[model samples]
Each structure stands twice: as C-alpha cells, then as structure tokens.
Target chain A: MKAVGEESASQELQRVVGAGRRADWVMASIGLAILIVAMGTLISVFADLIHSGWPRLTDPDFYTNFPSRRASDAGILSAWVGTSLVMLVTIVIVIPLGVAGGVYLEEYAPHNWISDFIEVNVSNLAGVPSIIYGLLALGLFVYTFGMGQTVLVAGLVLALLTLPVIIVATREAIRSIPQELREAAFALGADKWQTVRLYILPAARPGILTGAIVGLARAIGETAPVITIGALTFIAFLPPAPLQSDFPYLNFEWLNAPFTVMPIQMFNWVSRPQAEFQVNAAAAGVVLMIMTLAMNGLAIYVRFRLRGRVQ
Target chain B: MTSVDAVTEDPLLVRGRIQPSAEFLTHRRLADRLARVLLAAAAAVSVLVTTGIVYVLISESAGFFAHVPLKEFLTDTEWTPVFENARYGMLPLLAGTVTIAGIALLIAVPAGLALAVYLSEYAHVTVRETIKPLLELIEGVPTVVYGYFALLFVTPLLQRIIPGLPGFNMLSPGVVMGIAILPYTASLSEDAMRAVPKALREGGYALGFSRFRVATRVVIPAALSGISAAFVLGMSRAVGETMVVAIAAGQNANFTFNPLEGAATITAYIVQISMGDLPYGSIAYQSVFAVGLVLFIMTFLFNVAGFYLRRRFREVY
Candidate 1:
C-alpha cells in the first residue's frame, strides 16, 4: 500500500513537470511564429518594391512627365502633384476644425447629455467605413453643392472622413493636460478662451500635431471615398488653384478632367492582366509605402521629442 | 501701465467687466448664450455627416427596391449587375462576404490567441516590446499593399501546393486579410490576458498547475469577453476590407463555398461598379448603393455588438 501511494505521487509530479515544459515550448513556438511572419512580410514588401522600382528610378523623366499611353513613356508626376495638392488642402481644412472642436469639448463644454451624445457619435463616426464618406461626398458635395468633381470636393470629403480620428486624438491629448495648469491659467485672470490659446494649445501641441499627421496619412491612402466622389481616372493637367480658378475653369469643356491618385493608379495597374502592369503596380506600391512611412516616422519623432521636452 | 489701461478700455473687455445697467447684463447673457450656440453648432457636424450617409443610402436604395421586389433582391441567385438584363440577387455577394470573413477569422483567431498567450505569460520583456511593434507594422502597411502582395506573392505561393487554384481565389485574399488583422486581435487579446489578476496565476501555481494549463484554462476563460470582442472586431475588419478582396479575389459573382475558386464580395462588386463608366440613374448604379447599404448594416451591427460587449464585460481590475 505504501509503495503504490509513493509510485502514484511520483507519477503525478512527472506529469506536472512535463506539462510545464510543454507549455513553455508552446509559448515559445507561438512567439516565434508571429515574429517570423511579421518579419517575413516586411522584408518581402521592401524587396518587391525595390526590385520593381529600380527600373523606374533609372528613367530621367519619371518624376517630371505625365503618364502616356505607351508603356515605355508613362510617368507618375501628375498623380504625385494631384496627391500632394489634395492632401495639403485636406490638412488645412481638418486641423483647425478638429482641434477647436476637441478643445471645446475637453475644456469648455459641460459634462451633460448633449456633450455625451456628441461624444458617442464621434466615436461611432471613427468606426464608420471610408466608403460611406464617399457616398456623402457624392450626394452633398457633388450634387447639392455642385463642386463639379474638383480636387476641392475630394479634399473636403476626405477632411470629413478624417475628422473623427483627429477629434478623438485631440480630445485625449487635451484631457491629459494637468488640471493644475488650467487652474494656474485661470488664477492669472485669463478667461477660458485665453487659457486655451495661451497655455493649453502650446502644451498639447505635440499630441495635436501627431494626431494630425496620422490623420493626413489615413486621408492620403483613401481611394474608395475619392472614387465615390468621382475623382477622374486620367487627368492630363494639374489641379486648378482653389480660389483663383473659376468653376470648372481649366476648360469647362474639360470639367470632367479624368484624375488619378497613387492608390487608384496602383489599383488600376494591379488589376490589369499583363505582368508589366503588375510590376508597375509594385513600383507604385513602393512610392505609396514610402510616403506613408515617412509621415508615420515624422509623427513618431515629433511625439517622442514632445514627450521628452515635457518631462 | 499705459498699455494695461488701453487694454482695459477695449470694447470687448469693457463689455465683459461692466456690471451696472440692466441692458448691459442682458446683452452679456446673450453673448454667453451665443457661445453655447456656437459650441452646439460645432458638435452638429459629425451628427449631420452620419445622417447624410444614411439618407443617401436610403434614397438610392429606395429607387432600387421600387424597381426590384425585396424578395427577389434577397433571394435571387444571379448577380449580373453590368448586363442590361441584370439580375440583382444579393445573396451571392453576401455569401461571398461571409465566407471570406469566416475563413479569415479561422486563420486569425488561433494564431492571434496563441501569440497573445505567449506574449502575456511567457515572453521576456525585451522580446515582447520588439515583437509588439513588429506586429503593428503589419497594421501600418496599407491595405493596398496587402492587396498587391496577395496577388503577387501569396497567390503564386499557394498555386505551387494547391493544384487547380485559380489565380484570383478567395483563399489568398482571405488569408492575407487575416494576416492584416492579426495584430489587432493579438494586441487586444494580450491586453485581456494581462488583465487576468496575478493572484489567479499564483493560486494555480501553488496548486501545482502548470503555467500553460493555467493560461489555457484560467487566464483565457477569465478574459473570454475581451477575447470574444477581439474576434468580433477582427470579423468586422474582415467584412469591411475592400482592397484585398477587390484585387485578389476574382470578380466572379458566384455563390460557392470553395476557397480555391474565384469569388466576389459585396465590397468587391461595389469597387467594380464604381470604377466603370456606369451612367447615373441606372439600375446598375443604384445597385452599388444597395450593396453599400447592406455592407453598412452588417458592419454597424458588428460595431454596436462590439461596443456593448466591451462595456458589459470590461474588467475594471
């Protein structure tokens, strides 16, 4: 009886020890799998982009000329210019509105039902898919406002789509400002508006800027919304200046200026049956990725610098 | 001192500080009231945007329902939106969306959960931090990149092993979508696992329960609500994903379950219709909105459910 009891106890110990080893192995294996897959993906994207972009990088006119019908003659200069112009306009529209609204909600507005409703809706808006914004641009910007499918209308639509994200980030940043700072500003006889402008805005500038850049990156990649708003497929000319140009001014005859963006261009290229187009798509993908990465890196750097200074 | 006197004499300041006349007080109250009004107007933008989206979808879809019976739209098998004699059966598009989403979940959940468990319970701090950012890089990669990668890399690789795999099939896109969303699930699940109190793990350890057993049986179940939320959010992402399905999954609007064959999701069909030169006020054009409405409804339901789950079962500890 004593021997049997000892034997069972030792067996239980063995089982427990084995289970522990198995668990550690399983965890290690899983961690390895995730790291491997992520690394593999990053390397592959970089590799493919470089391989495809090498040829395009050699062409002297690649950065200066417009896309042409011939495969050997096509370039991305106009698309690049259009992308920059629209993105700049979108940032100009979204930053002030998003920041001011965030400040109002975080600093001035009372914690009441009205504010709560706005808050919930804002969060929900953040989750609304991008394509729906395109639909809104179609109905309101294009149809009701009659913007005539210009870059202005497209930029406005993207600004709306990115507003919620900017607002959410700005609100969080503003909320993180120390209450003591606000109290000090008020004690100095500054009114609410003065306090926000002088103390709060300067203090929260880093977070606000980071959020704006992130929002800009998101807007830049958006194709579906712009497509819905009737962004043209093949514009030969540069976008007209927003104020100086009359309604459909660059030839109202060409009011339906076929426009294309980096993402849209890449999408079109990728879907074509020819292998050359796929390679072109990969090259465009590289450009888009570089642009996105640059934006994200700048935002990250700014955030770190701001945090350091504050500390 | 002179500057201070000049500032005090400014009209806005004079209006702010004077507390004498009844008329002045009334005007001051009006100014305060106007500030509140301005704030309300600012807050109205988001609400108006949402309302506009819904109204547009509804108005366009109303025209669609008028022309095609709701029953036929819901039950029809063919989806030839381009042909003059097009059938507007939405079932096939919906089925394709669900199948792709389901397969993506199948791929993402296990890997994500396992990764979460490892990061939460096993990995060293250095490894955890390094791996976490790397995983998030997957999120940072634009969906368009994923779409091309799927078409260029994953499809070719799969064809090597899976005989009869179409160049554009559900498998590659679904798998790529799963990978794209893997970070979301893993990061969230890791948070949930970490939220399981140390005391629970200690108790299991005292009782001779192995670490793996404790993690699988105690920590995961304890964090099930959050884990489930992660899964739901992943599904929502999969359903909403457009570029991958548009590029990789062939635009054949057939109702089938095979991952190896070509398929068309609702978003893919929407992309196709939007890309072409379909005339305004045409049924083909209306169908895009109709499809958009369905997509909207599906994602909205998921979002609401996810919000509720996160609220109800969120662990304060």
Candidate 2:
C-alpha cells in the first residue's frame, strides 16, 4: 500500500510538470508569432519605401525649390519650410501653457474637485482624435476668430491638439521628483515659488523638454487638422512672419494668405494620377519619418540621461 | 543696586524699537498678489480651451441641423457631398469608421497582449530593453509613412492575394492602422501587467504553477482593467486614424459591409471635402461640421468609457 501511494504521488508530479512544459511552449510560440508580425510589417514598410523612393533620390531639384504647376519642377522646399515654421510656432505656444498648467496641477494646486475635473478632462482631450481638433480650428480660428487659413491659425490649432499630451507628460515628470527635495528647500527658508523656480524646474527640465519635443513631433506629422484649417495645398510662396504679416502691420486680415505642410503636400502628390508623383510621396514619407524619429530619439536620450543623473 | 543699573541700561533698547520698512512689506504683498493673479490666469486658460472646444462643435453642428433634419442625417445611406445634388447621410461614414476600427482591434488586441505577456513575463532584462525601444521605434514612425506603406505595399499585396481588390479599401488601411497602434496597446498593457504585484506571482510559483499559468491566470486577470483600457484606447485611435484611411481607403462614402470595397470614414470625408473647394456656408460646408460632430461624439464616448473602466476597476495591489 505504501509503494502504491508513492507511485501515485510521483505520477501526479509528472503530470503537473508535463502541463507546465506544454504551457511554456504555447506561450513561446505566441511570442514568436507576435514578433514576426511586428517585424514583418516594419521590414516591408522600409522595403517598399526604398523601392519606390530610390530612383528619385538623386534628383537635386527634389530638395531645392517649391513645387510648381509643372510636375518636373515640383519640390518640397516650401512645404518643408512651412512645416518647420508651423511646428516652431506650435512648440512656442504649447510649451509655456502646458508646462505652467502641469506645474500648477502637480506642485501648487490644492487637491479638490476642480483640479480633479481638470485632470480628467485633460486626459480625455489627449484621446479626442486629431480630426476633431480640425473641426474646432475650422469653427474657432477660421469662422469665429476669422484668422482664415494662415500659418498662425494652423499653428494654434496644432498647439491645442498637442497641449494635453505636453501637460500630461510634464505632470508625470514633475510628480516623479522626490518630495524630499521640495521639503529640503522649504526647510532652508525658500518660498514655494522660489523652490519651484530654482530646484524643481531644473530637476524636471529634461523630462519636460522630452514631452514638449514629442508633442512637437506629433504636431509635425499631423495632416488632418491643418488641412481642415485650409492650409493651402499649393503655396509657392514662403509664409509671412506671424507678427509682421497678420496683426497690426498688415491690418489684421484673416484671409490674407494661404499655407501648406509636408503631410499635405505628400497627400497631394499621392492623390495625383502620375506614378512619379507617388514616388515623390514615398520620398517625402522618408523625410517626415526621419524628422519624427530624430525627435523621438532625442527625447529618449534626454530621458535616459536625466534618469542616470538623478540616480 | 544691580537691578537698578540694568533698568537704567534698558532705556537705550527702548529708544531702538524698529519695524520692517513699509516698502519691503508692500513689495512682498505685491509679489504675492502677482503670483495669485498669474495662477488665476493660467487656470482660466485651461477652462477657456476646454469650453471653447465644446462651444465651437455645438455651434457648428447646430448650423448643420438647421439645414438637414436629424433623422435623415442619422439614417441616410449615401454620403456624397460633392454630388450635383448632395445628400447629408452620416450613417455610411460612421459605419466605415466602425468597420475599420473593428478590424484594427481584431489585429491589435491579441498580438499586443501577446507582446505584453512576453515582455512582462518571459523576456530577459536585456531582451526587454531591446524590444521596448524597438516597439517605440514603431510608435515613432509617422502616420504618413504608414499611409504610404498601406497605399504602395499593403494594398498591392492584398490585390495579389485577393483578386479584384480595390486599390483603396478598408482591409489594408485597417491592418496598417492596427500595426500603427499596436505599440500603444502593448506598452500600456505591459505596464499594467508589471503593476501586478510580484508576491502574487511568487505565491503561484510556490504552488508549482508554470510561468505561463501564472501570467495568464494570475497576472493578466489581475491587470484586466488596464488591458481593457488599452484595448479601448487602441480602438479609439484606429477610429480616429486619418492619413492611412485617406490614402489607402478611397473617399467613396457608401455604406458597404464589404471590406474589399472602397469606403470613406468620417475623417477621410473631412479631409476629402476640406482639400477641395467646397463653397462656404453651403450644405457641403455644413456637412463637414455635421460629420465632425459625429466623429467627436464617438471618440468622446470611447474616451470617457476608457477613463471610467481604467479608474473604476483599477486594483490598488
């Protein structure tokens, strides 16, 4: 009877071991499958982009001048400049507002329903689809504010779209700072404002900058919202300076000028019937991809550097 | 005699009674007041941006309702704003949006969950570090790149596999969108899974459970709320995707159930209309807002649902 009981116990152990091995195999297989799918998509995208864009890459004119009516003369210079100006303006507009809002929420604001409600809505706004921002821009900037399709209006709309992301990221960065640092400053007789300005701001700067850059990158890729604001599809001219062109110097006209962006230009190119234009679109994709990737890389580097320094 | 001498010496101290200067006090008060005012102004900006969005959407949508009846706009089958005679049907666009979102979720949820599981449960530290950055690389690729890929590669591949596939159809674009949002779902789900306490896993392991069993039965169940939130958010992103659908999925706003056929999403429709010259204040112009209102409502609902689910079912442990 003792021998039989021991035999049964060992058999049960074997059964459990068998089940465990089977589960491991299953999970490993699933993981392999997912990795394959993801890598396959990435590889194919690069392959296609190279295949389409390789032929036209040697064209010196591709990077030199603005697109013209003739297909052969078309380049992305104007669109690139326009995208840069709009992005720069968007960064300038969103960073201060977003950082301040984040500072208020994380460092100063009393914990209450009002702050909580704002936090909730801000998170919601982050998820509120980029196209909806376009609609908002159309109504507010174009019709109500009567700013028309100028670069300033486009920049403001993109700024609004990115505000929530910047705010959220900045809040996280600020919250991650050890409370002891703030307390230590306070113990040294530093006021709340002084502590935030001197110590907290410096400590949080890397993270805050990462968030702002990422938000700017997102705005750079955005096409739907800017398009809806009526950024000109075929602007051959450079965008006028915001202060000198639009406000008092230019009589505050809303419908004075038109604008275009890289994504919109690519869209226009892709929609055309010509195969060469499709190739140009792919090349533009490569450029836009590089720009966004550079920003993301910088952000990741900053985050890591900051984490190391803090440690 | 000593006490009398000390009292006489205190006369100098009595003559030296001093206070903080009035300018110093006023400057301090002014600084405090300025800080308060600045904070108030910042708070007001947040409120204004938020309220401004709702007001704009509502007002434009109200203009739309003035021209078209609510029932017809909601239930109509066709969406051709550029037609010689336009119909303001929003159903087709909504259906297209839902169809693509459904396909995208089908692709994203399972693969993303698997990636999350691998990273959280099975991957070595080095592997996790490498894979995490790779996943972020995927996330960082611009939507336009994905659009171009969908248009130039995926659609052609689909055409080869499935004969007579439209150059611009829902399936290719939807699949591309899934790839685009997969990192978001995976990263968030991985964070959620990691949040599940190590003690629970140890307890399961002590009971002789396998890592797979522990992960699936213990960790995943523990992080179900966050995983669900990630899934919902991914769906919202898929629905909101514009460039992919715009480039690969044609701007034919017909209410078709077939994935192989061209369909127009609400976003694609807005892009299509806005890119061209639709006369201002015409019915075609109002249709953009009408469609925008619908898109806004759908995304808002998803966002709210995702928020509540993440909050309500979030486990402290």
Q: TM-score of model 2 relative to the true fold?
A: 0.91
Q: TM-score per candidate, in order?
A: 0.88, 0.91
> In model 1 chain B, where is the ten-residue run with the lowest total lDDT?
B1-10
lDDT tens string, model 2, A153-182?
888889888888888887888888888888
- For TM-score, the strongest prediction is 2
Query: Candidate 2 at residue A68, lDDT?
Result: 72
DockQ of each two-chain model: 0.42, 0.41
Candidate 1 has what TM-score?
0.88
lDDT of 2 at A95: 85
Worst 10 residues of 1 chain A by lDDT: A249-258
TM-score of chain B of each: 0.86, 0.88
Name the lDDT value of residue B161 in candidate 1.
Answer: 98
- State each model's CA lDDT, in order: 0.78, 0.81
Per-residue lDDT of B138-248 in model 1, one digit per residue for the tens?
777778788999988899999999988889899999988887888888898898888888998998888877778888888988888888878887787788788888899
